[model samples]
Target: MKRLLAAFLAVTLAVSAPIAAMAGSASLILDARTGKVLASENGDVLNHPASLTKMMTLYLTFEALNRGKITWDTPIVMSKYAASRPPTKLGVKAGGTITVREAVYGMIVKSANDAAAAVGETLAGSESNFARVMTQKARQLGMNRTAFYNASGLPDERQVTTARDMSTLGVALLKHYPREYRLFSMTAFTFRGKTIRGHNNLMVRYQGMDGIKTGYTNASGFNLVSAVRDGNRRVVGVVLGGRTARSRDAQMAALLDKYLGRASSGGRLLASVGAKQPVEVASAAADTDAPLAAAAPRSEGEAGNAPFALGYSDTATVPLERPAALEEMANAGKPQPSIRGWQIQISAAPSADAARALLAQAKSEGGTALKSATPYTEAFGTGANAIYRARFVGFDSEQAATAACEALKKRSYDCVLLANQG
Candidate 1:
């Protein structure tokens, strides 16, 4: 009888080992340009997605914004159900309101479950209904093996996705919403007087990694979907069911190291994917949120002379449209003469003086490249929340602006080229 019991126990252990392994292991890497699978292991195995579900929620939000169903200033009121979601949240109370911009930052930077729920409720009127919409959208996007039961990736046996499906979603985000996709690279954003931070630490250490999502739960272990762009190469990598976040990130970094080099350096992948060309949408002036900041430390090979100051962040700008009256005020005391064509922005600063100082420093360091350019400061927002953009205008063409920007970059200045509508 003892021998029989031991044999039964041995059989049970053997049977459960593979099941456990399958439950907690899956990974895939793909070239975003060619859609070629670089490497995969159990990529089709279903697993919980955890907070990674917020990516889809944000995707739909971006779609809605593009469709004009909502704007950045649109308010998303939190229902009691949404506000009551578990921690890693913005903690907006029931009946409290946050703008669409804040909600997007909350979800992306903090992985706030409450923000996700509020966004879903605002979009679909109910969480269950939103789940259905999410599932339907997943199907539309060819995420065949994926399903979502909630806006937050809270535990639900029904909420499952495969690594391959996640890679598809990552690529879809980059292809379909190239402009909005930049939000994912943000590591922190100020919301409602509080600074909410993100947990995607790997992005800081790994060169070229930008916006993506990370997830974890007891059932899902640690999951991460990462997108990396080095020069002309781009790759999306997904790892699910890691034993810990560190291990998951390590694995992802290793995969990117091995596969990113092999990625093809074709032209814009968006063109090949048949993505709609991004159009310049009219910017709204009322949104008062601070610009999201990518706090990632500069990695080796990055061109930066000095570390960013305490309040200085990434050069990415929030939409800076000004109301007619405010626009007049911002341009006040400046000559409205002959600078036109294109512009290059160097930085956004907390105060107008700081912005001017940045422009002055850039002019001094920029050498002959910026000697003929006109320095301008554009102010946005109101009172304490206001930020100023330091810019150089008067480039004759896009190529001229691009050339100047390239020269500034080599000298370790962050630059963004823009068409001068004025």
Candidate 2:
């Protein structure tokens, strides 16, 4: 019954000064059998989703397959755009053709941006159009806070989501397409004579943890959405904005271990979190946490068909596991004075520099409304795992905050009005 829910951040820096080690954390656990939520914590807070966005990409692809719009053997050619995406990728050259089956494997196993983009373009004629469809699909599935800007979960300030929305997505993926969901459990697959392993470590290490996805961007932190099935009972769990993968996985495992039994036998109601009303679909234009230079391609036939053999380098995979000692580092810190006013958060960044840069671009795009607000960076998370949030903090009233965010949104920037919780 006791759950360490909110991840706290100190907020007592001088105005406009950047603070260190503050980040957001959110989670959701539900009984997959009954669609009943078991636990929720900051589940509605917007957080950078990272590669978890690919789950939607895969979902749409599965829809296409089922609709007969695409077939598994259909060719997914790597365009200049797809080939241009940064790695952890299968090194299919521009114009090189990989079957839809290979692309699916590349996505589930390698989390390849190129493969995802290829799938998007192949199905929707362009990634932007595909993203439009994605947003529509999200709205249909009740993912109101979610937005898509690209096929790949690469950093775009406009892309954002929440834990509850993702938990809903995970359930929808399984419930609507049980057959296609089986692909998520695949740990490795052979593609063009190379065997590629997946990054979802829980699929290999945890009991009944079949998988959904794993994501990381400096902005999003480590994220995982996983499902565990015990006989006829199943539970789905989602963790976002984790400081590290090992810590994230540990948190996920602890949640499943504690709740699986109860969920199996009908867990006590935590709270009924309903989805926001569906909105009309709007047209959309559309990494790892580390620099992708280390993600070089494997030479053909290098991997000797080992089950779960991966194609990425050590640096790309090393960060996936954090030292257990670091897990004890509490996110809670000394309380600081509240800003005591409303503000509009625009985006998140891995560093102060990035946060400042985003602020500049937002100001340029959001000329008038942003002019009155002071731009600042609030650090989220603690220690080396922290991320900086770009925000226009310091509004005297909630009405003022809402007005500013609405103005910014009209100009195509993502904006959320919120009161500071210092």
Reference-based TM-score of each model: 0.60, 0.60
Tens digits of lDDT, candidate 2, 52-169? 8889988877865674445788776677778778987888888787888888888888999988887766654446545655765676577767777677798876678889889878
lDDT of 2 at 387: 44
**Best model number under lDDT:** 1
Cα error of candidate 1 at position 256, Å: 0.6
Q: Clashing residue pairs in candidate 1, if any?
A: none
- The superposed Cα distance between candidate 1 and the true structure at residue 409, in angstroms, equals 60
Cα error, candidate 2, residue 134 (Å):
0.8
Which regions of candidate 2 are displaced past 4 Å? 1-23, 264-422
Q: Tens digit of lDDT per residue, candidate 1, span 1-422?
A: 11111111100000001122234778999899898889999898888899999989998888767755567997777777788889889998887888889999998999999889877766544465457557656755778667777899988877888898899889889988999999999999998787888999998889999979999889899999999999999999999999988989999999999989999898566322222221111111121222323223232111111112111223332343333223224435545424346777665554454455456556666777877787765555454334455567778777777777777666545576665545
